[model samples]
Target chain A: MVKAVINGIPIEVEEGVTILDAARKAQINIPTLCKHPDLTSSASCGICVVKLKKNNRMFRACCTPIEEGMEIITHDPEIIEIRRTVVELILSNHPNDCLKCGRNNNCELQKLVADFGIREEHFDKFVRDIPKDSSTGTIVLEASKCIKCGRCVDVCQNMQDVWALSFLERGIHTRISPAGDIKLADSPCVRCGQCSEHCPTGAIFEFDETSKVWEGLMDPEKYCVVQIAPAVRVSIGESFGFQPGVNLTKKTYALLRRLGFKAVFDTSFGADVTIMEEASEFVERFVHKKGTLPLITTCCPAWVDFMEKFHPDMIDHFSSCKSPHEIMGVLSKTYFAREKKIDPEKVFMVSIMPCTAKKYEITRTDEMFASGYQDIDVVLTTRELARMVKQAGLDFAQLPEEEPDHVLGDYTGGGVIFGATGGVMEAALRTAYYLVTEKQFPKVEFENVRGLKGVKETSIKIDDTKVNIAIAHGLSNVEYVLNKIREAKKNNQPMPYHFIEVMACPGGCVGGGGQPYGVTDAIRTLRSKGLYAHDDAMKLRCSHDNPFVQKLYNEFLGKPLGKRSHELLHTDYKARPVYRK
Target chain B: METSVVPDIANVVEKWKDKKGNLIMILHEIQNQYGYVPREISFQLSKLLDVPLARIYEVLTFYNYFKLKPPGKYTVSVCMGTACYLKGAPELLEELHHILGIKEGETTKDGMFQLEIVRCLGCCGLAPVVKIGNKIYGGLKRSDIVNLLSQYSKEGAPVAQPV
Candidate 1:
């Protein structure tokens, strides 16, 4: 440990700790850019400069380490001017289009300017050119609007463990660019929306597919059938100014009805079906290790794509079960069409989701078209639905709560949990436990597995055979745990997990990239609370209790992982190329 | 271990090559497999594929995702994801930059600490996160990044560049 004085207050910090960290330990706030606690520091912003005791030199606190007897002055007037000057220089090249930008009020640069009371600007704005990059389906980058804070660049390159953005050029010419200066659409961006999700300004914005959905709605000939995912009901309330955990499921259903959708359905019902197929597969794999050892969940398309591209060797580990949205699309077009006595071609199935990856998921060639067309037609984000509600001039909060149409809307708690990080694992467990033990599983909560946190791993013994379950939310966490498993192999140890669930976004669907932006852990917890609250309110908490799935097994699919199940619900994967970097 | 197609580069390598400027995704896949995405395959992707070499090179250089050079045996990518940043990525990133001087996308000359910055990596619970290759060192502090890098010293931690 090194003893250091930060901001004139003497504090003890561990050896090798940076001055910024030391300041943090001493409760001294140091503003910074190109530096994040979650990412490796670059110290490029020079915003965190502080005066060192002996040398009297102001150095970036992020890169400087604490010496045993070093003195640091964090907020000295000279230090303040240095920061203010840096801020001014950044603003000089940055676009001042805050009012119309998406992140206007929430922008970091705006907040910093106000925080520092920096009003004077002298540099010419025409020196640097900023353009909007909209190649990616879900996000746009307005380079001019960026303060070069590198928050977006940091998130894309470091946080997600998917490097899709970087700083191009040097000094004043430095700017963020996607690969090869290509539009985002051409890159392997995955449309996770993390960059926009973290952008301090309107630089990164979500691509609104609302107008297209609205166009289709105005076209009366189109029988638009909307399927709301489990996470949407909880998150949609936020757009309407409701509390985070509030249940707007009924209100959402009613709003969709007023908006002119022909039928309102629950993705939970599809999740129920997914659980049926997944649990049965789990039992077969666990008992026999016959198929993919350590079966990985396929519910998150982002994880599936990642594995396909990078970890194809682990492909067999994933259950071939399609996610609830795709399953619902197929069933709605097929079973629902037959039930309604309508041609499947006439019905358009759309998914209301908390995910941006679903956009790419639907584009996959394997996504079915039971009606002999694309199984799902268009996907709207939770935010997009809220926008459409606003555009329709409807007050979502005032709308009376109502239930979804019968058959497809009815579901269980097991299905609702699919929106959470470990929800899929927990859902699969509810049924897998029963099938594996040949008796009712003791614990229903699976309390060990449920949380809005990142990576969670646990093992349970079923009939004396221990089954390990690992759950990871978001890409970086997933990458870590997966590597741990690989390290175990290198160490000559057997694999640790038997089943793994990976959600591309944080907190699973509740913190989806396409959900409301500005959601923190506190907000994610509120939504997660809504998930469990909704679960507890339900009569059937387990997937096996889903009568529809039972009926499907009794009628369409003979059994789980059966010949029909393989043909309808199962799919394969492909390996992808790594980036040269 | 035999590097069969660099870890994760599967059949879809060809498809990624087909899409112009898809080098970003291709680089991600390659990085996933080999711990560090190599330029050899990236060059191959450009020559045999529709994407122009200049475009591919520019893409590799532009995006933090596409590394134009070989990666060290271990790559430490810190997630400055929004959640992590709100928590503490800025602090973590600072120490890493200082410890390894090549900036966000550059690798150490010794090929030890190939520091990269990735976007959102999903673990808000474990904010201030750093993934050295596939191993995630979560709830990170400045010391943690240094310690993790030091562990690779036998393999090699980057020696600081002389002023």
Candidate 2:
């Protein structure tokens, strides 16, 4: 234990706890720019300066540990003046066009400047002339706005293991870019958007495509339909005044309808259908030995991109099923268009996703065009939808709840939980158990495969077979799980797992790169809790019990992996160069 | 001829693989051999060391010593230290730039001479010194820049010059 006094207030905390954390425990909030709750502090920004009374030496509270019985002065007139000077220096290099900036009012630096009452430019303005790079078509890199926080670099290289964004050069000339200063589209980016999620400013952000959707909606010849992903329902409420974990599934459907969509479907319905095919594929792979063991999930597009780039050797182990949104897109174009007697060409399918990678996934391959046209015409992120709701002059919190269009709206609890980490494994297991035992899986919930653990390994017994499962979220966690599989293959040992689920973002789609900003693990857990709460409250917990999913299988597609299902709901993977050029 | 001589990148990586700070050390070796770190060599080292190519570029670019492009046959170094600056070094540098048709840190079209403005060469007594390759010509006059450059442009010229 360590006892410390912060700002003359006595406090005690465990040893090795940073002075910033110790002060936080005592309700003393120290201002920080380079420090994030989700990342290690690099102490690049000199904002969190504190003085020790013993020697009167200054220290960065973020990186300096709180010494036992130490007297620390966190905030004072002198410190405030120093902090103000630091902000002024940062502003000198920063652009003055905040009103036109993407981050605008939401930027941390902007907030800090306002808080410090920086009304005048103290230092000479010397903003860099670096041009913006939007070559990825998923995220933009505005180097001029970068404050050298190192958060995006950490998120890209350390957390996601994508190594797309890097700090090149040094000192004042230091700038973040893909290796060799190549276009991000040519780099090993994977279009995950985690870098944008971790970025404190508009230096990195999702590519805004809201105007394209608006143009399509106004076109009289086009029949625009939209669907909301499972994670979008839980985390979208943060943009409004609601709590982090509040479920606004019905309200979002209502909002999309108000925005002039002809039909609003649920991506959870697509998730249920994905479960049907994926579970049956697991049965074929695990029981019949028709395919390789450890069938990996392909629902997260960022994970799909990473697998294609980094781990193409495991392509045979990858499940061929398309993601839920793509399934909904194809169904919206082919089945929904036929049922409503509308022209398929005029049907523009837009998916509201909690992912930037989905923007890339819409046109990943020819399989996305299985409906004879682009299955999904436009993809809006959850953050984009929030902006659209505000732009329409609609009171999102006060909007009346409305149900989705019945054809593809209804979903089971298994489908809704696909938003969280280890969710797909649990959802697939529920249906896979039923397929194997020829009976319903009594205990639908698998608590072992839950939470924000980096890698979760568990096994379930179905009649005679013991199925080993591994669920890994975040791209860095994947390498460990993959190494085990690779080692087993090399050694000619037994298979390590029968099933594996991977989500590129930290806590699956709930913490997606496209979700509301200012996300920490606490927020991720709350958003996940929202989905799990919805799952617990529902009557039909298992995916196979979804009446609409059964109706789709019976009415159009025959069996799980039948000709129509294979054509529309399944896709293939190919090895790709990490660097395009 | 330069393109035909592809040095073994594997041999360089193998030499530094067992050492600490190997990435930076290996990059130094590459810069020493090639006069600049090539993109193809960076890719090869990235695979050999199991490090990301982005990280290698970060190291390559952070240090000003490493160059990304091929250097010319001869380097024209103009000392810009306090002594040299006071002794008409700026005029000498301008004369070289005009004659070579290139600015500091740039090579000429024919790839014969590259211009660079360096700090102190530890020869303050011989202020306004201009060095070309291994030979140093001290107390240089701006008017003598044409004669100095022409002497190096000719092949099989004397490598040493009177200081």
Question: Cα lDDT of all candidates, in order?
Answer: 0.76, 0.92
Q: Taking the tens digit of each residue's C-alpha lDDT, what string does model 1 give over A154-193?
A: 6665556656666666567666776544566655566777
Off by over 4 Å in 1: A1-87, A111-121, A126-131, A183-186, A452-454, A479-494, A555-558, A579-581, B1-163
Give a tens-digit lDDT track for model 2, residues A273-319.
99999999999988898999889999999999999999999999999
lDDT of 1 by residue, B52-155 (tens): 34445555555544555667667778887888888788888898888888787677887777777888777667777777766666776676666667767764
Residue A137 local lDDT, model 2: 90
Residues forming the 10-long window of minimal summed lDDT in candidate 1 chain B: B1-10
lDDT of 1 at A139: 71
Could you tell me the lDDT of residue A76 within candidate 2?
A: 86
- Residue A375, candidate 2: C-alpha displacement in angstroms: 1.1
Q: State in Å the error of residue A231, model 1.
A: 2.7
> Could you tell me the lDDT of residue A136 within candidate 2?
86
